[model samples]
Target: GQHAELDVMRKVEGVAISPRDTVLVDQGMMTGRAGIFAGGDVIGGLMTMTAATGHGKKAARAIDVWLSGGHYEGHEKSPPVDFDMLNLPLFLDAGRSQMSALPPEARSGFVEVVAGISDREARYEADRCLSCGNCFECDNCFAACPEQAVVKLGKGRKYTVDLDLCTGCAVCYDQCPCHAIEMVADVAALSAEAHRPLRFKARP
Candidate 1:
């Protein structure tokens, strides 16, 4: 059995104590009081270090918004990327980069045993991410298109297909490894609705 001592917190007015003996807060982690907020173990639920860290980050952002007289409007929630959505063939089989560590013979008391990886190694390891359902500009669709309808919009600007040049062959859709491209059928009208911008956010 565990208990949270709310003796000091009880002095604060407008705060509500839940039936479970935890602090009742809103979506922004704010309690009944206008400026007061609660998070971490005091708020209950999964009491883990990772959860506490996430709470701290969220609370900090909320506090910043409150200070600026603005409501904390978080980013639009998106569905989690599952393993099945990943295009495994597009990425090469590269092993994870391991941190440099001192040998057992060289180990000493109080001395750091593990060392941070080099910038190059860090970049290499980060690049290994699957980036599931998102396009990383692999240029597969551009190369696969028979009509050369795929227009290259350099760097961060994603590609767009020229509808006039496109023949509805669906070659670009098939070649897209990350499932970012989707096929929409409308033979009667091949207007703007037929095309979708290839933005950073992938289609669910």
Candidate 2:
């Protein structure tokens, strides 16, 4: 038996080969089979449990979007937001609040060990939630725009640019995390369907 190798994947390998195994995937997990999604060790990227778990969630969302007459282009990654990106003057290193802990005697029981923070501490933590490569409606654009071209739509709505008023100054784009906004030919008139800036330009 030393000469023989265990081929557990033998049954499935070379069975559903499409676009020659390595070139068919549209995003990564998608195979040639319609409505079928894949992940885990079978997909062969990271091949780790954590990567597979992430793929599972990604594939689930992809399937949902495909069923709903749309496509999920995968999670849009942004530049890492570090301390240098933030206004350092605003952060005084006041230190983080401690979470309420349960004593050893209380831990002896089956009850939850960690207790919740106070209302004030909770609010303080909530306030610290930064926009950070994602828009949280900080209203910085509204306040910074001298031309008033950028309009805040408030809760449950998105910001809009009045092209008639907008001078393409890029102040709004510059203010609200350039990592979040892509500078296109026309800042306000970019294609809604454009999924991030494609590194390889599309051919005619």
Candidate 3:
């Protein structure tokens, strides 16, 4: 029955089959060679609504391009609309809804099933994030450095240790409230791990 169905379908006009069927189908449909491209569970191995929509959109854009002699440059320069400004109620403090899972026995056969959070719940969870203080280097060590050897990197004011003036006094390490600074040996020798014992030699 399946062979007969295949033979009947193959006999349809404008059908072209090749050994590299996947590549040929994709190129033909996506490039607008046939004016339209479509396939489902039978023609394409993976059958999903998401994949079908993506293929359809690609084919539509290709057709538009061909009809316009490829002259249209779609959406060249428009500043991105700030999504935050959308201020949808979806962004407000509503928590997500819990989903119920299907039992193992009930989900034995092929079926489309999904568990997703409600919009309200998703927004409430997002509101819990702490957008707190400056993202770059913390200000604790910068404020505490007695020698003023640390340099402010930028407008956000992240600090970096200046090697030229640093005396390796370890004062910055001790004073930093946030513990952002640590004193290590100078740049000459880079060690992956700190040497356990300082190799001290008397200078003549």
Best by TM-score: 1
| Model 1 ranges with Cα > 4 A deviation | 1-80, 185-204
Model 2 lDDT per residue over 9-75, tens place:
3344432443323213457356656666666666556657779798887888788888998877877
TM-score of each: 0.53, 0.47, 0.30
Clash pairs, model 2 backbone: none
Provide the overall lDDT of each model, using Cα atoms, as 2-decimal numbers. 0.76, 0.58, 0.47
Candidate 1 has an lDDT of 0.76
1 or 3, greater by TM-score: 1
Give residue 166's lDDT in candidate 3 (0 to 100): 58
- How badly does each model clash, as a count of residue pairs? 0, 0, 3
Task: Name the regions of candidate 3 deviating beyond 4 angstroms.
Answer: 1-9, 12-14, 18-23, 26-33, 39-46, 69-90, 93-97, 101-204
Tell me the alpha-carbon RMSD of every candidate. 7.2, 10.5, 17.1
Model 1: ten consecutive residues of lowest lDDT: 195-204
Residues forming the 10-long window of minimal summed lDDT in candidate 2: 195-204
